[model samples]
Structure formats: C-alpha cells, structure tokens
Target: MARVLYLGGLGRSGTTLVERLLGELPSVCALGEVVHLWQRDILDDERCGCGARFSACTFWKRVGEQAFNGWGNVDVLRVHALRDLVERTRHIPRLAAGHMPMDEVREYAGFYAKVYNAAAEVSGADVVVDSSKHSALAHVLRWASDVDLRVVHVVRDARGVAYSWTKTVTRPETDGAEEMTRYSPGRSALLWNAHNAAFGLLGRRGVAVRRVRYEEFLTDPRAALIRLADFAGLTLVPDDLNFLRPDHADLGVGHSAAGNPMRFTVGRLPLRRDDAWVAKLPPRQRRMVSAMCGPMLRAYGYPVFTEEA
Candidate 1:
C-alpha cells in the first residue's frame, strides 16, 4: 500500500516545512492544506502560496494517481469521497469526533496502498502528505484501519503568530487578500487556541502524535529534517533537499497574503523565537493574548514572561 503522513498543526505554525522536508522521499508527495471541504463552493478558489492551483498542481497530480479510479480533480468531491472511504473502512463512530480503531487503521493503509500504487503507476511516487491540519482529520488518519499513518504536529509561539499579522496586512507569501479575518482583531490568538486545543487531545493520548516546535525546526533544519525523516521512516541524504527551491514561485504575492509561504525561503538555519509582538501589538491586545493563552504557551514550553511577572 502507499504510505501516507499527516503533517498538520495549528495554522501558520510551520506544518509546511514538515511537508517540504518529508517530500525528500522518492515515494513521498506532500500537498499542503486540503481545505476543499471547508471551501466547497470554490474549487478554483486560487493557487496556494506554492504557486499552483489546487485543480492542476503538480502535488495533487501525484495524489490523484493514488486515488480511487483516477480522481480527475482535487475538489470537494474527491475530499468527500476520501473521507467516506476512510469512515467506512475504519468504522468511524462519530464523523465529528473522528474516532477510529486498529482494524480501521489497517483498512485505511490498504486503501492508501492502492492510491500509492496508482500514483506510482502514474507519477512514480510512493508516499503522500496531506496538510489538512485540522485535528478532526488528523484523528481519523491516526486511527483509521485502511492506512499506516504518521501525524506531525507543528506549533508556533502565539506571540510570533500575533505579531505576524501586524507586520503586514497581506500574508507574507500569498498575496490574495479576500479571506483575511477582520471580524475579530484578536482572531490570531483564538486561532492559535482552537487549533492547538484540537491536537492537545491527541498529545494526551500519548500515541500517534509528535509535536514539532517551529522555533526548534528553524534553528537546526538539517538535524530537524533528519529527525523528522527518521520518524517517518525514510533515509535522508544531504542531496535530497537541494532541489527544493522554496521561492520557486510566488503565490498570493501582490494582494494580502503575500508574506506567507512565498515569503518563506527554505534553507539550513537554526530555530528562532521571534518577538515581533513585543513591538507590534498594542498594550491591550498583548495583555489579552497573554491572559487568554498563557496556559497553552507554558504547556508547549514557551515562557509566558508577562504573566509570571
């Protein structure tokens, strides 16, 4: 069967890095944020910051090779179909809860093997990475019977994520601006909280999940990649990542999400904990994020200095 990995975590938390690095395996193909179900109405919504449309990207092309009956487009239909197949194979009790069993995991693995073989038949890839960082999706993948699944949890400091918004209205990489969450100014903190809350449950279970701190991954990329590759059961050679040009194309460059992935350059570097919030946030906003998420920060080993003091 085809091997699959779940590279998911809090949004804006660095799951992309995991996807890119894992792509090092000849059998591995990583497709970030399959949010088609959430945005079911807009299949041609836009290309990700990676500079490829969800409809015709090289990444999805590889995944399509593994899908049931050569799924033509990576749309709501494909996602729904995949979700249903997983549910049936695994005997998922709650669609919302997303719980599964060992038997289901095996079934899912077998189904994915079919996908991988199909992908190999078409695109010659052996593994697939799905960056649908939602905890519900992650839960299903971890326990489903049809596949062998690995879940990578990525987390960034809440402060760093909050400050990121202040740096620019547009995302650093993806310039597309229509979806910016302006309803709540403090939405980043809420996003950080909700995203983590979902995965925090898995951490408590003490199996099928591993957390990757964004700062740590950035600080020692090669070592981090090696560790990650090892966790996913792949042999890592120095040459595997050289061909990865993070800035190969700019998605969401001109509009609002410009500073996203397109803004991120893939390179060998050390982990960093940026304090952009220190200078960017107003006192009230900073206080609110601190007051609201102080516990989560400490739980992840991040210091909540203001709260302690």
Candidate 2:
C-alpha cells in the first residue's frame, strides 16, 4: 500500500488549499472531497476546486465507478454502510495486512485505493493525497490495519473560520456550524478544538499522526509538504514541487452546476494570526469562539483572548 495522508479539520479550514498544494507533487494523486456528497445529486460538480468532474476524470471516474460497483458514486459515508455493493471485498485484503501491501494496495488506503493509486501512478507520483475532510472517513481509515496512515490536521483560528463562514460559503467543503443541527456560537470553537483533539486521541491509541496549523502549511508549502512527505515516509521528487501549478484545477466527481471548488490561485497569504478573525467577525461570534475555544487556542499557541474581538 502507498503512504496515505488524510487532511482533516473542522470544515472550510483550508483543506482545499492543502489539497491543492500537496497536489503540486508530481508523485501525488490529489483527491478533494473524496468524501464528496455523491448520493444526493452530487451537489453541483462544477469542476471541483481542482476543475474536473467528480466522475469524469480518468482517475476519479474509475474510483467513482468502482466505489459503488456501477451503482454510481455515493459521496456520503453512511451510504456505504447501507449499500451492499459499497466495496468491503474490494479492500478487505489490503486493510487486513497489518502493514501496507504494495502489490495489492487498495482504495485511498483500501476500498477506493486502487483508483487513487492508479491515478497517481498515471501522474507518475508515488504518493497520494486524499483531502476528504471527513472525520468519519478518518475514523474508518483508522481501521485499516494494513496501511500506515498520517493524519494532517489543519487548524485555523475560530475567528478566521467564522469570518470565512460569514462570507457566502464558497462550497460545502465544510458543513458550517450554523448548518448543522448541533450548531452554536461555541460550536465552531469546540470544532476547532475537537479536530485536533481527535488526532490526540488517535495518537494515544498508538496511531501515528501529525498536526499542523493551516497557516504553517501556506506560509511555506515546500517545507510543509516535504515534512509531510517525510512523515509519511514517501520519497520526494521534483514533481512534488509543482503543488501550485495553474492547471491544477483538475477536480473530482460532483455536478456540472456546482462550478469549481479547486479554481482559486495556488498561493494566498496565511490567515492573520492576530486580528484576522477580528477584521472579519462580528462581536458576538468573536465572543462565542473566544469563550468556547479559548483553552484550545492557548494550547495551540494562539494568544488567549483578554476580551473577545
């Protein structure tokens, strides 16, 4: 099995940007929203943020097709539990090996592993990036005893997330806190804490994982990705350096009208450490996040709020 990396955080926490930057590697077959909403009409495929259809690309097309064994792509993870043909046999062998099996590497790490690995091989990359952003999937990947897994937990300031949330949600990249039934002003804050916390739990369970700030990744993708590759034990090459290629707009299976989630520039300034959330958030939301995620902020090295922004 190939080295598998998962990018997870509270939604909209820059997973897309991380995917794009990692996709720069010639050896990486970058997958965004592999956990995409495949069941409910594919919520507008519009070229992914990568600029390709969820089911059209030669790589994703196969994964899209194979994931459901011809029933069609189903993005929702729970749906796999409901469907008989969702791909247990497809990955059981790979996942049971207790260590990654190079010859029989299966989807992303098992189930959809082949499609992703095939695509990466096609791209001449030896490593693959699955920016599914679904904690559920991360939970499942945890069961793959065969594959060595690395979880790249991307965290952003609650204020940064809140500010981005205030703006029109560009994509369902993350189901914003307000969108969830369990949402609360403190929800995003706890979420920011929860994502990293889960990684910690996994670590205690003896899982090998690495956590990085979304800001650190963008500030220097080269160092970040290289460090990431090293953590995964994947070999680095020149192709891996092209994470910001303009044509990286290639995307996964979604819908035509959804437009492209992968269309933005390869580089952007890191989220402001001090006043980013301040500049974008309203007083109430700022207060909520500060009050809610305050301890986590301090733990991760952010200054504690004296008074909410």
Q: Best by lDDT, which number? A: 1
Could you tell me which 10 consecutive residues in candidate 2 have the lowest summed lDDT? 251-260
Candidate 2 residues 1-309, lDDT tens each?
A: 556677777765777666665665545656555554354225444344434554444544544554455324444454444222322323323333334443322233355454444445445556667776555456557665554567887777766775655454344423222232224446666666666666566556566668888777666656777888777677777654643333232322221212124423434423223346665577777777777888888887776674543
Off by over 4 Å in 1: 24-27, 37-42, 48-66, 70-123, 165-185, 204-207, 241-275, 306-309
lDDT of 1 by residue, 1-309 (tens): 445667666556777555655554555655445433124213433554445444455544544554653344434554455556554412423432444444544454444345445544554555566666766666555554445566788888876677665553443323445444332337778878876876766556543567889888766666777777777778867676564434331122211011234223433422344555566666777777776788999999987765321
lDDT of each: 0.56, 0.55
Regions of model 2 farther than 4 Å from truth:
40-52, 64-124, 170-184, 237-260, 263-275, 306-309
Cα RMSD of all models vs. native, in order, equals 6.5, 7.4
